[model samples]
Target: MKSYLAPKFIIERDTERCINCKVCVNQCSFDSHYYDADDDKVKSRIGKCVGCHRCVLFCPTQALTVRENPLDYRANYNWSPEVIEDITKQAESGGVVLTGMGNDKSQRIYWDHLLLNASQVTNPSIDPLREPMELTTYLGRKPDKIDIDKQDPQSIKLKTELAPQVKLDVPVMFSAMSYGAVSINVHKSLARAAVEMGTLWNTGEGGLHPDLYKYGNNTIVQVASGRFGVQPSYLNIARVVEIKIGQGAKPGIGGHLPGEKVTAEVSSTRMIPHGTDALSPAPQHDIYSIEDLSQLIHALKEATNYTKPISVKIAAVHNSAAIASGMVRAGADIIVLDGFRGATGAAPKIIRENVGIPIELALASVDTRLRQEGIRNQASLVISGGIRNSGDVIKAIALGADAVNIGTAALVALGCRVCQQCHTGKCAWGICTSDLFLSKRLNPDIGARRAANLLRGWSHEIKDMLGGMGINAIESLRGNRLHLRGIDLTDTELEVLGVRMAGN
Candidate 1:
């Protein structure tokens, strides 16, 4: 909180050309610009500026410019200019390389290439305004078939149904991020938002904060290798339990929360020693194979009394279909595929960009394989990693996903510039930081509203897309590849996507 070790970049305004239109003031959320009471002139606080360039880009007059301090370190190319600079800054202070949200680089985010379609003039589009659009979706394992006829007419059924459904108001849910990695207030915000929106929020591998148990109905507690804060009581409070296999940002790596960020509250919640690093092992010891995964799943089930759904989240890779199929057979109620391009608080840049397959292909392949094996209904599939907009969500559903989990996009809605500094715990936007003062910049109420608005907007767009496709419900759009056609795809690609050539 004292000072940013790297020399700061400041934005200066040309007062001669500046009108008191308050455009820059309105544009900047960082409170960098303020009106001087005495002179009625706009003043800028250089220390507060994040150099996000929002004000500069939106300024009506070309009156603003940003410049870095002369003492700032010059860019180097040891491991790409960006990586070199990030490393240089972090090394200078000996602090963690903090970042917000997930990996963001031009690494073939598959959603861009795949396109969505609408019905032609010959086909009629449904009027969503006049008719109800079903956005409600259910998560958890689904039954292949129900048999009630075997029961005697007079006999009462004593045993309860095996699996219960966890319904979501929207198809999108918040991704896991632990209390220690973020803040309790941030967790509370997400919890309240999930409750209000009727979605779910993941507890990440950091374990559950006792204060957040009130949102248990909408929470998905995670069990990672280290099992930092996990207990039978903690496991019993969630509607869903996600087993963290690997994250997209650091596929083969584990997470380490330095002692500096693990405050007393975080320590207590995570049940780790205070002033010690919280280390989550790269992989669970019990899960060495598909059979091992089932054992762990059953262990959790036994601990939680089989009440909650268990989700296995893995980074989407080349063999995602086969892995997901194995997960289904491993008693997984839900399978979450985190694409390689997914974001993390802090991860090795090499892993973020170079690892994993795109969600589009992963989702399509998994869905196809599940259906082919006739186990598509055995467990639900949720896709994550780079879903940028509503079109991406719709396309993902069409490619065969029960729902999607959004992390980077949600933070952006809450005012993140994707600066990739979340690991440092000093987010300019305040959404990803633990500093109470800086964190206050994000009013959870307003943040939740903005997040809700984004989801609502996307939902409307999804409905519009579905309407144009002559689909009355979103379920109808799920896995309906007949509504899609492949363009510029090779024979193998076309075959994999289950689409015909453009001309045909």
Candidate 2:
């Protein structure tokens, strides 16, 4: 069958400046660039380009230009170019259209609709450079009230017993991206960067490699439906244990790591046979009800000797607020909400774009519900999915997120271009592939420095934003919707976000 699918990108190489150095020939993993021996020139197969820009960056002469292929299809509002292409792909392959990364649709980004308040006449803004600003965040269950005795007027005693907590210098942590789906070096970079930034990185259900045990203090090992590598030592070595109930990209479904990505190390770490695909079930087999979930939580606490916080991660669906309420009552010390925009190594394109609610709505509703129920202190809340910058982080904090996770942003820091071709396992940047040759392209030291630098920069920006609001500490911003104002938002949106419209 002659495919009707048009090339997604167009690549042009200038002959005047072309040196035919074969740099692009070796750089592009997609086989878009080629060396023509007969013509003694470098050429391109434009149809093969995924637009990752590997050749453009490595090109010394600046002779290459890659841009979106302007294939002029008849304009149809209801049927978009992407839609048509997707239909075409399915017709040819007769398989589910798979994509990598988050939803690229034109959904309303709540972060853009919201604006932060700045102090002026009534309140004076403090200069972060001159004043001591606090971004310290603690994630875990908090006591409803503390009973203290000021015995000597100098010392206090008789404090209520507190649950285990994971202290972070900043209210930002790395999101879970499993080992087999990505590479070992990616995990190494994330772990090292988490340690450097005084934050934590999650080992997303794929299990922890032996090389990462040293960074366990900054690790959050995950237990999912598959229970790939849930061993005693794995639980004991981490600062926190997270049960991944669902993810935002493809909620209500399981995860699949292609057999090709499961290398020997991944097999050893996950306790699976070599080259076998790892498929996590949609639900934990033993967890049929909230009671079952509570039991598992208690069992994990017992396994950890009551030392670490147990976090339950769920995708932000319509009833997220209600679900989160149950999780806290079930003894979850921390609850993680992954929004629709969360990234994944692979997922059905339809599910990634169609499923899950926005994190903003879910966060506000959950926080409000928990507060109304007087159980807000029972667990801390962390949100992920589509957190782009420090501004998003601060807004999320204002909306009641204890902290925010950055998955795609962190990958971008480590040389990812958001090409959305991660499912192919032919990543030229080496950030998303398990192939040894491509994996080596990403140096762990460099990747760690880049990711850590991103956190440092964002933390500074968060402090600056907090100072502008006359808030010296990030904790003060939690659930303070008064500091947030909606712009061009509907009345219902304003109500749902718990914020007044701009110019109110």
Candidate 3:
């Protein structure tokens, strides 16, 4: 009952503007809105409000408004209200605090500190409208050298031996979001969009649904520690197989899908018992060292008959550079580096905000290390975490990433309000929920078109940016650090980004 002592959000209803339609009453999932028979008016129970703005968006009368509570609790910098509330909640329930989405704390977003440079008087800028710009990217190991025979001087024959490669029409791919964490509609939408965009979408530790197996040509199947829903048929269908070592949201930790969300469809897809907790151990017990990782990499390759490329994903930690080098040496065709800003279905509030390094620094350092070792061509690099628009994607490529993964941005396109209440399995938007009624809020056909439009529009913007840099092709922007400059940063910070100050 003490939980009602303080309401975080205040829901206000204007009696004059209200039409008594009770739309808010029917729309609110939190049960915050109601009708008082004696008063013959609509009212709000502030204690139950979560400030999602769902009622405000759906209300036609324009009578409802929600705001943060202004109540004070003896403000203290060291013992702030948030701190006190956290303590109280912990004291009340002996459970770890959970949060969804990415870290919300104030941290240095390096992208904001850096700026892109355009052509000057000496160098002329090319117009994308008049040029044939290339956006095609190949994700796989490339041969050190191609051989040609000089035996026949008139007709020289060349030997072509290539490892597995996944061709993309654009340099963006959807990041991991498991079947249990998101609804089947989301998976269907992403699958359709990926096929339309000529890119790929990932199945993050969740087993593939039989209905979605048809999208195998444009899907990347993930094998996480729990091995949920992973079978030989799943491996044989995907164009690429990813071994998930960890993610940025909760590095050094496994994933947890609460039992409440394990519905029949989710249960069938994951091949797990219904109404039971789904847990992925912190580390794959079978993998302990680089050699162990290599064993698994080769084992996956063997399973797919060397027809598909294998990718290894790791969070950007302090030792990410060395770790990436080890992964490349372990025969991984691709390396996915997830930064601190990466999103998740659910994670502990503490770890989500404090445990990983930024992708900018990690990408720059890993690229430099790999180049210095003369093995940069051994594996392709993909980075994710807080990639918002086409500009962010262009900047990431300039910083040494071959591609950027879009997660939160895609969810936003599907109408997510970023309420950060996904862990409760009661998402205001249907993108993150398992409830049949809530899940129906998203139509796969419409969501697919929206996702496709976002990618298509972003691809055009990327080409325009490349053209502004006096380049006609996107490949010229890849790892070309000279095209970027830091605005205001220490020398060390600039060095880590491998970019000079603007005007230098």
Answer with 1 or 3, whichever has the higher TM-score: 3
CA RMSD (A), model 1: 5.2
Most lDDT-accurate candidate: 2
Candidate number with the higher TM-score (2 or 3): 2
* Every candidate's lDDT: 0.80, 0.93, 0.90
Candidate 3 per-residue C-alpha lDDT over 446-502 given as tens digits, one digit per residue, 9 for 90 to 100: 999999999999999998888888988778889999999998799999999999999
Residue 126 in candidate 2, Cα distance off native in Å: 0.5
lDDT (10s digit) by residue, model 1, range 377-462: 98999999878899889888888899999888887887777756677666655666556555676787788787878888888888
In candidate 1 the C-alpha lDDT for residue 470 amounts to 82
- For model 1, what is the C-alpha lDDT against the true structure? 0.80
lDDT tens digits, residue span 250-320, model 2: 99999888888888888898888998888898899989888989999999999999999999999999999
Q: Point out where model 2 deviates above 4 Å.
A: 152-154
Candidate 3 Cα deviation (angstroms), residue 464? 1.4
User: Model 3, 468: alpha-carbon shift in Å?
Assistant: 0.5
